[model samples]
Target: MRWWLTAAVFWTLLIMAVCWLPMPMFPIGTGGEHPKRFPHLDKAVHAGIFVVFGLLWLRVIPGPRRFLVVVAAGAALAAITECGQNLPIIGRDGELADGLFDVLGVFLAYPLATFLFRRVRDKQPVVSMTRA
Candidate 1:
């Protein structure tokens, strides 16, 4: 199996675990005195996770339409994760801003993936010549 595929799968599972597992989530907690920290730190965390998710998908499936499709799927997953938190069984609260941030992170990966692949694709191997 390709390394990229492995990474993508691993990341997807990690995302599911992180989003679904019942844990004491900080910053997003409701009716609790959260730790004293910078505001909206959780928003940054949410965006950062999906950014890597988008990048991994781009590498796993190398094509325009396919990449877009995978990314759309990622966005859908992001939304679903947020919505899932709203379930009383999940013991977490969902926020519209968090979902927006997650989707924003997914798109953010586009330009980054483009830049990375271009740089790698355009890079030329250096050769040194030693002649007698």
Candidate 2:
């Protein structure tokens, strides 16, 4: 539990840093200098990052309401990141599609994480303590 919480905090900060960083810091080919080999690659990256982000939060947050809270928080963070990108000083453009991809990533992560958790749980051996 402690490890999961620490991971969640670390990952969240990493995401925030990536979103707030300057455009030039990104890979050279990611921009208009050359035709993008994979035009939608950025969206895919956003989705992938949010998927991990949501899963990390889910691991730390307990209760039946965990899914709802995590998804909402992920979406809010996505929106805020997109808005931040629009700041003139940042010189980054905000796109609705990016936010949509972020939300989709979080939503998709729930089922994937649930499946993995169940698989691992089922494979674990039961242990019993006894006095000989």
Candidate 3:
């Protein structure tokens, strides 16, 4: 499969998963009232998107260029998702933390993807490109 296509699939699936199975509310030991909830499950959604997209990027684009494109796409998607959530029809609120989480996710996932790809490719042939 094409790398970008894989990324597209991953993004779609991740969103669907989050939408379909949202995190259940749990008390954060904040006493009888005004309980704070853990958001790890929510944050995981962003991390998952980044990790999957980064893997797709590593598979598709080679070298430093891969980082640039993948990060750009991830950032753009995060921004768009944040904005989209604000629409009345969406019945969602926008939060800066979500975007921040996405950025962190991309930062972590990209390096991990690169490392895994390299490890997987070790002792194997590297892709050769011909300049026109």
Candidate 4:
């Protein structure tokens, strides 16, 4: 449990760092144009990160309350990161679409982690001792 929480915290901080880091100036024709080559690639990456975030939290969270807490936290974090990007120091713009994708990722990952966890647990062999 501790390990799970630790990992979640670590990942959250890492994501924050990546989100807040100032962008480096790219050579002409190499920066903004690249994103056009891969439509919605940024949103996909944002979703993928939150998906992992949701799965990590699922490891520590349990019961019916899991969804509420995990989703809320994930959404709050997403909002914060997006808002942070708006700061001039960060040199990034905040996008509502990105935040939406982040929440979407959390929603998608929660069920997946729950299903996988149950499946793995169900398949585990049970050991028993009996008197001979």
**Cα lDDT listed for each candidate:** 0.80, 0.88, 0.64, 0.87
User: Could you estimate the TM-score for every candidate?
Assistant: 0.80, 0.89, 0.66, 0.87
Per-residue lDDT for 31-129 in model 2, tens only? 434235667777888999999998999989999999999999999999999999888766688799999999999999899989988998999998879
Runs in model 1 deviating more than 4 A are 24-36, 124-132
What's the ranking of the predictions by lDDT, best on top? 2, 4, 1, 3
The full ranking of all candidates by TM-score, starting with the best, is: 2, 4, 1, 3
TM-score, predicted candidate 4 vs. hidden true structure? 0.87
Q: Mark the 10 consecutive residues where model 4 has the least summed lDDT.
A: 25-34
Please name the candidate that would achieve the greatest lDDT relative to the true structure. Answer: 2
What clash pairs does model 1 have? none
- Cα lDDT tens digits, model 3, 8-118, are 677656654443332232233211232256435666666676667656755676666777777887777677777776666554555677777776777787778768867
Candidate 4: tens digits of C-alpha lDDT, residues 1-132: 899999999999998988877766423321343565877777888999999999999888878888889999999999999999899887788899999999999999977997998998999998778767
Select the stronger candidate by TM-score from 1 and 3.
Answer: 1
Of candidate 2, the 10-residue stretch with the lowest lDDT total is: 27-36
Runs of candidate 2 exceeding 4 Å displacement? 29-36, 129-132
> Model 1, range 57-93, lDDT digits (tens) per residue?
8888855686677668887888788888877877887
